[model samples]
Target: GSRGSRGSRGSRGSRGSRGSRGSRGSRGSRRSVGHVGRVCQAGPTPSAKASSRASSRVDRGLSQ
Candidate 1:
């Protein structure tokens, strides 16, 4: 099946003519780091998560 990949840009790279999915839910290192409860670039680390969630909700056209 043709889909997204989850590996990195290594020297050898992936093989076998197959790859992993690239969905956000499948990313092991996924961390919502952005403007959540505060300014994404300037807010404290704590507020960043909140700001990011807020942003994602808005991005998805969902009411926050």
Candidate 2:
């Protein structure tokens, strides 16, 4: 009946919950980036130099 069709729309609410989880995941990634930036700043190893440049690019991107 019409009620059965209406029930399908309830599934859309689950998508909204997933959106919040995605935001939390973004926050986690930003924290990891910050940690990497600190390590790059503290000790400039060969690999850290590359990470430093990448982090600089990220900063510029954020600024622009």
Q: List the residue pairs that clash in candidate 2.
A: none
Best by TM-score: 2
lDDT of 2 by residue, 1-64 (tens): 6877666545544443445445544664577567767787766366545754565555445433
Tell me the deviation in Å of residue 34 in model 1: 14
lDDT for each candidate structure: 0.37, 0.55
Q: Report lDDT (Cα) of residue 46, candidate 2.
A: 65
TM-score of 1: 0.29
| C-alpha TM-score for every candidate | 0.29, 0.31
What would you estimate as the lDDT of candidate 1?
0.37
Q: Which parts of model 1 are misplaced by more than 4 Å?
A: 1-43, 62-64
Q: What TM-score would candidate 2 get against the native?
A: 0.31
